[model samples]
Target chain A: MEQKETCFAKRVRCIVKLGGAAITSKHKLETIDEENLKEVSSHLRQAFVPDSTSANVLGMDWSRRPGQSEAPSFVDDFSDQPAGDSESFIVVHGAGSFGHFQASMSGVHKGGLSRPLVKAGFVATRISVTSLNLEIVRALAREGIPSIGMSPFSCGWSTCQRNMTKADISMVIKAIDYGFIPVLHGDAVLDTLQECTILSGDVIIRHLAAELKPEFVVFLTDVLGVYDRPPAEPGAVLIQEIAVREDGSWSVVKPKLEDTSKPVEFTVAAHDTTGGMVTKITEAAMIAKLGIDVYITKAATEHSVKALSGILKGGIPDDWLGTAIRYMS
Target chain B: MEQKETCFAKRVRCIVKLGGAAITSKHKLETIDEENLKEVSSHLRQAFVPDSTSANVLGMDWSRRPGQSEAPSFVDDFSDQPAGDSESFIVVHGAGSFGHFQASMSGVHKGGLSRPLVKAGFVATRISVTSLNLEIVRALAREGIPSIGMSPFSCGWSTCQRNMTKADISMVIKAIDYGFIPVLHGDAVLDTLQECTILSGDVIIRHLAAELKPEFVVFLTDVLGVYDRPPAEPGAVLIQEIAVREDGSWSVVKPKLEDTSKPVEFTVAAHDTTGGMVTKITEAAMIAKLGIDVYITKAATEHSVKALSGILKGGIPDDWLGTAIRYMS
Candidate 1:
C-alpha cells in the first residue's frame, strides 16, 4: 500500500501504558483482568476517537462527576484536524502473570544462555510473553483500536541487560505514520553481552517517548497515584504533582484537599523479575525530563479519563485526580 | 548477553516450511492438524538433533523400511556434533484459515485502506495471522524446538502488491547465528503503493533462500509430491525432480514408475486468498534457481526425513521418494 499523504507527523502523539497489575491478574497464572481491560480501553476510545462524527463517539454520554468542574473535549485545541483519523496512540503493556513467572524461573534477566537448559528457558519465557501480547492486541481490537503487536524479542537487540543496543523504533514509527497503534510488551531479548535479557515495558516507553517526544506519557497503574508515604500507613498522603527544575532539583507536592485515610498497600507481584513500582516511577521521571507531561494514575476511572483528556486539550485539569510529573526546563 | 563464539556461521543451515495445509485445517477456522503437527515435528527432531547421547536421540530408533536398503543415520556424516544443541533451522508457514478470511475481507491484498472500514480490516487481518503464529510457535516448543515468531508485517516492507520491495533477512540471519529458529508466517503488511498487502510464506522462503543461501529448502506439505498429471488420474505419475539452469532455464522430470487411479483435485481452501499448489511450486522453482536443493513432500514420513537428512550430510539419497528441485548449473 502506498503511504498516505496525511499530516501524521504534525499531530500530537501520546504513549499510554496499561500496567500489568491493572489489566491482568498479576498473581494468577495466565489470567487477564477482563473488566479492567475493557474499562481502560473504553476510556482510551473516548480520548482518541477523534473530535467529530466518529462512529464510536456518536451517542456516547460523558456525564459530569460530582465536585469536578466541566472539562473541554480532548481534541478541542487541535489546530488542523484530519478528516477521519483519531489522535495517534501507542500502547505498551507489562507482562503480568504471563511472563513474570517464566522469566523469574529462567533467570533471563541475568542474561544467561551458556547452557542448553538456559536456552530452553529463554524460549519458554519468550513464548509466555508473546502469548500475553496476542491477548493485548486482541483486546485493543475489540475496543475498535487499530493496533498490532510488535515483538521486542525479535525487533530489539541489547548489549547491556539494562538498556537496548539496537532499539529499532522505525517499525513503530511506520505503524504510527500509517495510523495503527503498535502494542509492545516486556520481552526476553537477544543481547550482545549477556546473550539474552529482559527488556521491560517501562524501558520501552522511556526510549519511545525520547524518540517520539509525545505530548503526554501516561502510566495507568493500580494505585490512585504516587503517594507521599506509601498509601498504606496512617495519614499517608497522595503526591499530586512532581516538578523538576532545569538544575535537576525536584519536589513532590501533596494534594491540596486531603482527608486522613489509611494508606493503601502497594506491593509488587511475587513473580515480578523487574523491580516494580520504583522502576516505573524512575522511568517516568526520565521521560518527564524530556519535557513531556507524565501521569501515574488508577486506570479506567472517570477522574483519570478527565485528566488524560484535559492534558490533550493542552493543560493539566484543575481537578486532576492523579500524580503529575513535569519538567521546569 | 555476550555473543557466543560458536561455529554457527559455518554450519549447514536449512529452511523448512510447514505448509499451512500440512499443519492446519484449511477448511476450518483456526483449526490445527494436531496429529500432523506432532508427527512432522517429530521427524524434524530426529533429523536435526545432533548425534550424541542426548535423551531424545537415545530413545529414538531409525528402522529401515521393508525391502529397502538400510538407511544411514541422520547425523552420522557430521564430523563434530554438539552434545545437546541441534542443527539450526528456519521455519515459515502460510496463514491458512487463520488469516486468509480476514485479509480477503479487508481487501488487504488489493492494498485498500483509504477508509475506516478498510483500516479495520487491515487490523483484523493482522490479528488473525498473529494468532496463528502464536499457536505454531507453541507447537514447536512442545516438540522441543526453541523457536520464536517473527512477524513479516513488522519486519518487511513492499512497494508492490505482487512482490516484496524490501525484504529484510538480517533478523533471520541473526536468529540462525544465535542457534534459534525464527518461525515466520504469511502476514498483512504495509506497502508503499497499496497501503497494505499480504506477504505469503512462499515469498518469504524465496527471499531468505536467496540471501541466506542455505544448503536445503524444504516445503513439508500435505501432498506426497508433485505429479506429472495431478496424481489421481489413470495415466498420472509423480514428477520426482526439477532442474534449473544458471541461465534461468528449467525442466521437470518424471519418476521411473507410474500408476494412477484418478485425477487429484488441487484447489485452495474456501477462504484462502493466496494461490494454492501452483503458487507454492512457482516459489519453490524460484528457490531452485539459486542452486539450493528444494523438497516438496508430506512432512512426517520416513521418505521426507531421509531426503532432508541425506542433503544435510552432503549427499542425496539414491532412493529418494519426494520431488527434488535442484540447479543443473
Candidate 2:
C-alpha cells in the first residue's frame, strides 16, 4: 500500500496532551497522586468514549508527566504486577520529570551530539520515556479501553531523519487502517538538524492534528481552562477560545523564542511547544477550520467527552473568554 | 479464538542465547567488538535465513551491550538525536528492539499483561530498556542481520505471576511452528510458584528437551565441550552422556548442588548453574531414552552452525564425554 503523509489514515481521531503542571508535583522528582489520577481518569472515560457505542479512538499516550523523585504514573493502577500503589490514565509520559530534569542536570544537548556521554545520556533519557509509555498502556487497559503503547522513536513519531520523508506519518496511517489507535506523545525524538530534539506533547498533538485532520483536538489538563496569563499567575483570567490565522497557524507571535540562539535546554525543539493559552487556542481554532471542530478546555477528564460530543454535534460551547475563534468565521 | 491457559502464548520453539563473554570484551566494557559480533551475527544469519530468503522470521531484537560504569545503555543508538559517538546504531536498529525492550524494562511482562508505567521507577526502567534494546537492534542491523530488540518485559516476562501451565511442552511446539526462532537468555521471568524468577538458559533448555522430543538439543557456548572434574584438575575427561532413571528423571546418587547457603541471589529454583557439564550430560543422557540426543559444545562463530546441523543430522559428536543416562523402558 502506498503510504500517506499523515499521522492518522482514516478513522475519527483526537489528540490530547497531559498538562505538565498537572503531572508534576515538584521538579525532576515526584510521584503521581492517586485521587487526582482517578478523578482525571474517570473524566477521560466519559470524554473520549462518550458514546456507549463508538470505537473511534485509535490510541493515546501520556507524553508528558511529573518525574524527578519517583511518582505515580498513568498506568500504575493497572500494572499487572501486584504492588503497593499505582495510578490509571489514558496517557504516556516520556519519563517527563526525568526527561527535562535530567536533560537540565546532565546538560545533555544537541551540541553534545555524537558525543559518547551525551549519547549515553540520551539512552538514559529514552529509557525513561519507554518505561513511561508502558505505564500509560497499563492505565488504558484498566479503564477497559483497548490501547497499545508505541514509542515515537520506533513507530515513527516526529523524530528521526526519515521523519522528513514522512515515514512516521505513514506508520500511523497503517495503524489506523488496522483499527488500532496509534497512541503517541511528546518524546525524545532524534533530530537530523539538531543532535537531539524534545518533541513536546503539544507539538505532537499539533503535528497529528494538522496532518491527520482528526474530528478534533482536545487538550485535557488538570486546570479548568486556559488562563489569561500563566496559570501560576494570581487571578489569571481563563481564555477559553484561542484565536488563530486562517490557515490554522497560531496568530499569537512567540515572545519567549526571541533568543532563537538554539533551544534553551536538553531538547532541540521547543519553539513548537504550547503557545500556552495561545498555542492550544490556535490549534483548536485551526482544526475547527478543517470542519472537525476542535476544543480547547481545561480539566479534560471533566469535559473531554461532553466537549467532544459538542464538537461532534457541531455545538461550539460559548467561549469562556468570550472570543469566538472559530464560529466567528 | 479461545485463549490458551494464558491469553498470550509464547512458545520457546527456537531460542538463541548470546554468550555474554562473546558480546563483551573480556569483562571490560569500553568497546563493542564488531569483529566478534559480525562473526556471530553472520552465523545466525545462516541458521535462520540460510538462503537469506526466508520470510519465516516474524520479528527480532538485537540488544545493547551491557552498560559500563553506569554509562547509558546501547539504546541511544536509535535515538534520532544520538548524544554519543559519531555513529551509534541510530541509523540501523530494527523496531523490535525498542518495542520489546520497552516492554521488558517497564516491568511489563507482555503487551497482553502490560499497560504503561505510571510509577516512576518502573517507568524509568522501561525507557532505559527501550533505549538499550534499540541500540542492540541497531547494532544487529548494521551487521546485516536486520534484527529488532525484543523486551521480555513488554510481554510481561517478569512482573506478573506466570500461570505455570506449559505442560513442559511449549518449546517443542514452537519448533513445529516455522519461523518461530525466539532468542532466549538468562532473564528475569514470571515464576508460576513465585512472584518473580530468573530462568537460566541452561535450565529452560533442559526442560524443553524433555517435552519437545527434538532429536537433540545443543548449547553453542563460548567454551569447548565440558571437562570432567574441574578446569584446574589435570586429566579431566569430557563426559559425553549420563545415565538416568526410567521415568525421564535424573536420579543422581549425589548431585552436588554447590552453595546451599548463598541465598540464590536472583532465582529461587534449586538447581546447579555452574559446571553444567554434569547437569547437561546427565539431563541429555536421560532424554536420550526418549530417543532424543543433546549436545553442549563450545561456541565459535565460524563453526557453530555446522556443528549444530551435524548433531541434528546424525548423533551427538563422539567427542563429547559424560555418563550416558537413558530412560529405561
Scored by DockQ, the top model is 1
The CAPRI category of model 2 is: incorrect
Q: Candidate 1 — which residues are off by over 4 angstroms?
A: A1-12, A51-83, A256-275, A312-319, B1-12, B51-83, B256-275, B311-320
i-RMSD of all predictions = 14.3, 14.1
lDDT of 2 at A47: 52
Looking only at chain A, give the TM-score of model 1 against the true structure: 0.80
lDDT of 1 by residue, B131-200 (tens): 7787777767656677778888766445475577866566666777677778898888888777887888
For residues A1-329, could you state the per-residue lDDT of candidate 1 as single tens digits?
11222233644468988788888886666677999887887788778866532344321111122354342132222233233666788889997767676666547788656545556667777877787787778777666677778887666345465566677676777788788888888788888777888888888898878777888888898877766555666775666777766664556644553433422222222212332656666677788888888888898897678656745336555576777888876
How much lDDT does candidate 1 score? 0.68
Q: List model 1's recovered fraction of native interface contacts, to 2 decimals.
A: 0.26
Instruction: Report the Cα lDDT for residue A322, model 2.
Output: 24
Q: Score the docking of each candidate (DockQ).
A: 0.18, 0.07
Q: Which RMSD does model 1 reach against the true structure? A: 10.5
